[model samples]
Target: MGVFIHWAGTAALLAQLAGAAVAWGADGGADGVVAVGVEEFLGSTGDSAEQLLRLDLDRSGTLRAREDGVGGGWRLRGSSSAGRIDGALLDAQGAMVFNNHYADADLRDNVHAFADDVVTAITQGRGLAASKLAFVGSREGRRQIYVADSDGERIQQVTSDAALKGSPSLGPGGVLMAYTSWQSGFGDVVLKDLRDGRERTILSAPGTNSGAAFSLDGTRLALTMSYQGNAEIYMASVSGSRVRRLTHARSVEFSPAWGPEGNRVVFCSDAGGGPQLYVVGRQGGAAERVETGYRHNTSPEWSADGVHLAFTGRQGGGPAVVVHDLASGQNRVLLARGEEPTWAPDGRHVAAVLDGALVVVDSVTGRRRTIVRGFSEIREPSWSR
Candidate 1:
């Protein structure tokens, strides 16, 4: 038997977690202190579920758990019975705000779903607690693809190629994954069905094939293929049966990422004498430069909302994660030192590699928390929708 959870709430918590002083409400008031009660469980499930829920809320950047003595705001309380956990959200006056239930054979999955629901009810925004991440990690001196929950738990290796692999991209809902592998002595794009553990070489063209990205619809892929003599951005069917070249630049073009609408692709190129960002249509056309005011920019990932673009930019002679507003043309550095950033489903946070560990950063508040570590080297984290 696994764990189950139920919760509900009416009022929302609009607070920002910053420094030691916690502020709640729209005006950053000291009132309305939010807290998560320790969950009571039967058997030996322990308090892991409660701890996970608390961590999820804290990482949201919109909520924090106040101490026991703190008063006001809403409180989350729950208990378990026969592997079933029932919970509710109560107002400061001890009145019920909301109630709901969740059941899954996997305890972690149940907790993640519950956390996501709580975040949505309070913040009116999507929660990444249940999202999935795919990245490249080294094992036995060989790099392979790995997957883990958004909280960096339940880590699973997806590939055992025993060869170098990189550029991992997860499809919509995380049912499919695409990555570049060197098992054939050439960079080839391999697609894997995460559920059934089945994989196939999707793009095995001569020269090198890499930088594969799934479209918003997951029906097509945009990648950089050099089989045409020079590396250029190309679009191919998910089965790799039909290929359409999208870029013909003399300078090498790679790291293609799909726009939110699936009609445009943003990629990195050295055509401007230095690595920079460019956008091209899905049907193939002249690329236009995306001025980031930086000498070097790469790994452009569009936010789910289609309003912002996250990429790696050179700052202070080191790599930094930068977010560029497509509408206002304003660029802000999210991380002082990080690279290969991928946006969370909510578009409010980003995951990147920092000092050989995976760190999630709140793009709005610039708050960072390390989620996954102890890997030899992690690179190119791709978050599922």
Candidate 2:
């Protein structure tokens, strides 16, 4: 059985910042903190367009989620190319808190971003609406990488390679993706720029070269290569310059996940008699085994706060997604029917492939939901920054 642990300090800080709201009293008047109504969104703001562009509370004031039990679910009613948006903000009480006119070309993305910011302001929770996911799907007859919104709304193909391609991982800031492809007749680590749809070969070593993950700052990458006679972990800059070997063990090392601060990395290795998660410093050091009760563990992913490690755990039945708390030495299984778990930007949710479809689970509430379906088979779904 996994032990329960209290939330860390960072989460507490976020709560304090986000829940700093002031509600109204029985007198139908302003109390200690002024409560802004939905009318603020209309009526005589000369710089309404500018306020919509800023989207910050200081520029347009905060709004509640509902007012008079009429309208809720803050949204961007309309927008244009001038960076203007007719936006809404709400508080935890479902009261209308703020609204303004705004302009922007990509209204959908802007609305999601603003919605996330609003949610952060009201609930102290990290906003993941603007985030995305990258995964491998065999829907096109061959394994290929694909991209989708965090909620699995916009499913788009990232690579159209008619060859074997898998192990998709998103780079820092969600601007790039690195995956292994056999289009060149051998396993090679390929980097694809998601911004402009550009592709480049990062590592085409003689032997197997796969399992690539980006560092926190997107400056470096950690991947496994057998060019040195054994499958080992290596670190290289994003430019493919300044290459350095990290692990020299005889056991195969792959699935390199950089810690939040980028000072250390967690990877799967058989150095301890079987495949298990191991942590080593980025510079170089002796690897220490991560304590867990499972007989086998692999596909480890480090949380953004550097306090948790999520990976696949197997006992006698099948594989399950498990999260281990680093600070308290406590671990918990997040999902009993999934693999290749990846953390969202908020660090509160994890996405994995379950029953050949993409599913997401809440780490705190234990709520499971399917985000993407209809794929013949999807694997290695990675959430972007």
Candidate 3:
């Protein structure tokens, strides 16, 4: 076999690590080597609730989750089982000869291998920690909620139970949050006060109620309700109880995002055959096409300055996060593979769901990095207003 052992597979990972080191007589010799072993825990259920989140490892060449010799809960906890060391020497031939050393049952060998792959992964595209963010995730087979810093620090589970909860949309000034919860038989929108940790029910109906967004002045809220049959946009006073429908369409029109101007709202509709982006006046009026191209433009989020609108689009190829420039009437693809493109409060960057992980991106630079490798699926990551 070759000096350096390169093995990658869903089941071949563990065997290769242990086998590689022993073959090179790296068990215990003159020059010891660096080794590493790493394991990841996916989401697990009732007694064990049965919520299981698949590990979506983003790797190109040859990468797969190793399940042999590792057994436990939803975690990357395991012992370092194997090790191998490789070095270069000045041989007689002008070319450098690669030497391979293998260690038998070395604790450090697995760690060394882990480190090599981890470093290589980061250099590829995985970002280093920076800012913090709070999102919802399911654990132990239950649909709970969590808040983690943007860098995956201080991860705290906010809600504990089997009921579904998430879509933590921010308010105008970052003082409040509007989210949806299925604690009841139907989905209900709730307004949360960030200061005193108080929550109040804003709206509830018979159908799916979602996409709660606060207006610019923080005086009113725009959400989507399906009480009238199909989902439609609605405007409700921030502190008052009066609610009015903004659209009377017969199609499934929801996901209302308030525009920066505070006088208009953009939503997604399938009235024209496939799903597309549409705009309507705040008080209610005829809807206009805001974006064109794909029939699957959904989850519209207005930029802070309201110059552009970002939404999800699915062409024949795959799903992508795109931005629609209002003046130019052009659609720009920000991410080649992602969904739910939500603009930050500053509107300079976007937080999108890429490969089942949330990633922050600088739209102009076309660069992205992972936030953390947690959660089964992430959607509707809104910025703190």
lDDT of each: 0.81, 0.72, 0.60
Which candidate's TM-score is highest? Answer: 1
Better of 1 and 3 by TM-score: 1
Poorest 10 consecutive residues by lDDT, candidate 3: 45-54
- Count of backbone collisions within predicted model 2: 22
Better of 1 and 2 by lDDT: 1
Candidate 1 — worst ten consecutive residues by lDDT sum? 7-16
How high is each candidate's TM-score? 0.83, 0.78, 0.63
Question: lDDT score, residue 366, model 3?
Answer: 61
Model 2, which residues run further than 4 Å from truth? 1-104, 122-125
Error of 1 at 37 (Å): 7.3
In every candidate, how many clashes are there?
7, 22, 31
Global fold similarity of model 3 (TM-score): 0.63
Candidate 3 lDDT by residue in tens digits, 1-385: 3434543342465554445444223322232211211234222211110001012111111122233413211112222122322222211121333322324353232223332233234223221122224465654456554555433445655555466777777664455777888878678887777657688777777887777777767777888888888788899887527788999988888788888878999988889888888899987989998756887888788887778888889888788899888889888899878888777654646778888788877665565768656777556666654
Per-residue error at 293 for model 3, in Å?
0.7
Ranking by TM-score: 1, 2, 3
